[model samples]
Target chain A: DARVTQTPRDKVTEMGQEVTMRCQPILGHNTVFWYRQTMKQGLELLAYFRNRAPLDDSGMPKDRFSAEMPDATLATLKIQPSEPRDSAVYFCASGLVSTGGSGELFFGEGSRLTVL
Target chain B: AQSVTQLDSHVSVSEGTPVLLRCNYSSSYSPSLFWYVQHPNKGLQLLLKYTSAATLVKGINGFEAEFKKSETSFHLTKPSAHMSDAAEYFCVVSADGGATNKLIFGTGTLLAVQP
Candidate 1:
């Protein structure tokens, strides 16, 4: 079955370290989204790409967070000098163009990051 | 800005009892609502969605949600609960395709089913 795949299921690093998360979206999906889930904020959209071009990243902290799609199949989110508050489960989900009323999604297993 | 609210923090039910999870949304445009379930240590799974076609939307594993615009509620209900139904449930809302399609998720509700 087609599924969004994410790498490094778990990661633990010291404060001020850099953390990178990777996602491989479904083969035919046209949209990719990155979301972060934490206890305080619940789940929030961090970034999104339509047709491999980033459309929005306003929810992301520009000072330390960056998101990019080098290729159609791969999207990456990077954090430089991560802080303890940056620790959370990051999820990647893919969907098609929302032309019609129905638009479903396929999600990755998520990367759990911990900044100590 | 669109937002969602999941009313219950946690709910407990028996194996064969009916299940209900409450969700409400606020949006400027015609809203599209979605329900997602997350198992322990697993990613979120789409259960169902209300995208203006039908008020009653059916989803995988016998889960269903009804969209009520008058009440501003999109509550999920199952005829009977299974042990595997125990998970965290999220409510989502979006407006249009451009950037509003980027969903706003509610604080999830944890469902626990006992034997």
Candidate 2:
């Protein structure tokens, strides 16, 4: 069974520290999405990439948050000078959209970040 | 733009009892609605989805959802609830129809199943 893999299942950082989360999508999937989940905000889509090119990052804070797919297999989300409010579970999901496939996303376990 | 609303913030059901989770959606075009369940310390898992083809869609773990365009709702239901069914349920809508499968998730409903 293929699954999306995420690194740093748990992270604890002091405020103003830089935090980086990584994801390895299913081998053949071409689309990857980053979402942040919080008790107050539920789930928010931060960014997404198609074919290693970013399609949208409007939901992310441009000043501190960055998302990139350095290659098809690796997608990363980094937060510089992270704040306390940035504590949340970050999920990475992968999907295949090219073959007229169902618009279903397979999600990784998620990276839990706690900023103090 | 597309959005989803989960009517209940939390729902409690007894084991072997019926389960109903309400969800309503608004979209410019015909929307794709979905139900996702997340267990504690786990990622969200797709329960079922309703595209245009069928009004009633069946999903894993004996869960199903019906799309009602007249009411703009896609509510999830199950005949019997199990203890393992306790989780956070999210209602999601495809934000851009089928272009990129971008999804807008509702503030989830937490389901508690009592034994």
Candidate 3:
């Protein structure tokens, strides 16, 4: 069965460390989304890419957070000088968006990040 | 701008009892709505979705939801609750009724199944 794959299921880093989370969307899916889950914020869409092109990143923190889709299979979310407040679970989801598609998303097990 | 409101933050039901989780949405136009369930330490799974099709949508795991345009509600329901059904349920709305549109999620409702 095809599924979205995420690296580093759990990560712990001290404040000011650079953190990177990677995702490999299911093959044949054309859209990838990054979402952050937190107790205070529920689920927030950090960014998304369609057809390997960045579609939106307005919800991401421009100073520290960056998302890129270098190719069709790989998507990355990076945080430079990560802070303690950034501790949360990040999820990557993939979907096949088409005229007759259901618009459903297949999510990867999230990457839990803790910045001390 | 589209948004969803989960009426309850928590709902507890005994096994074999009927379950109801209420949700209301606000949108300027016809919208696509969905229900997602997240188990502890797991990713969110799609339960069901409504895209202006039939008013009632049936989903996996014996779960279903009905979309009410006049009430602006899409409430999830299960005839009999099970212990395995304990999870966080979120109501989601597509900002623009498209796969590419951002999905606005409601604060989840934690469902507890008691024996």
Candidate 4:
């Protein structure tokens, strides 16, 4: 059974520190998505990549948050000078697009970030 | 803009009882809908999806949902509930006219199973 893998399943950082979360999508999936989950906001889409290229990242805060897909296997989401409000569970999901469009997204266990 | 709304913030059901989680959607075009469940401290898992093929879509774990176009609803249901069914459920709608397949998520419903 193939699954999406994530690094640093739990992270605790002081405010203003930089936090980096890594994801290894399923080997053959062509689409990758980054989402942030919070109690107040539910799940919010931060960024997504298709075929190793950034497709949509409008939901990401350009000033502090960034997502990159340096290669097909690795996708990363980084927050520089992270704030207390940035404390949330960040998830990475990947899927393959069939004739019917994108299929079910396989999500990682998520990196839980706690900024103090 | 496409949006999804889960009617109840929380639903409590006893074991062996029926389960119903209501969801409603708004979209300009024919849209794909999905139900995802997230257990405590875990990632979201896809339960089922409706992509315009069949109105009644069966999902894993003995759960299913029906798409009602006239009502703009895709409510999840199960004949019998189990203790393991407690989790947070999200209703999602796929964005229209995009090869990227962006999704709009609902606020989510927390299901509580009582023994």
lDDT score, residue A21, model 1? 97
What TM-score does prediction 1 earn?
Answer: 0.93
Q: Write the per-residue lDDT of candidate 4 for residues B19-101, one digit (tens) a residue.
A: 99999999998888999999999999999998888899999999999999999999999999999999999998888633456
lDDT of 1 by residue, A1-116 (tens): 88899989999999999999999999978889999988888888899998999998998999999999999989999999899999999999988874663555668999999999
TM-score: model 2, chain A? 0.98
In candidate 3, position A38 carries an lDDT of: 95
Off by over 4 Å in 2: none
Which wins on lDDT, candidate 1 or candidate 3? 3
Candidate numbers sorted by DockQ from highest down? 2, 3, 4, 1
Candidate 1 overall lDDT versus native: 0.89
- What candidate 3 gets wrong by more than 4 Å, as runs, is B99-101
Model 3 TM-score (B-chain only): 0.98
- DockQ of candidate 4 is 0.53
Q: Residue-wise lDDT of candidate 3 within B20-115, one digit each (tens)? A: 999999999888899999999999999999998899999999999999999999999999999999999999988767757467889999999999
Instruction: Please provide, for model 2 over B2-78, each residue's C-alpha lDDT reduced to its tens digit, 9 standing for 90 to 100.
Output: 88999999999999999999999999988878899999999989999887988999999999999999999999999
Candidate 4 interface CA RMSD, Å: 2.2
**C-alpha-based local distance difference test score of model 4:** 0.92
Clash number by candidate, in order: 0, 0, 0, 0
TM-score of each: 0.93, 0.96, 0.96, 0.96
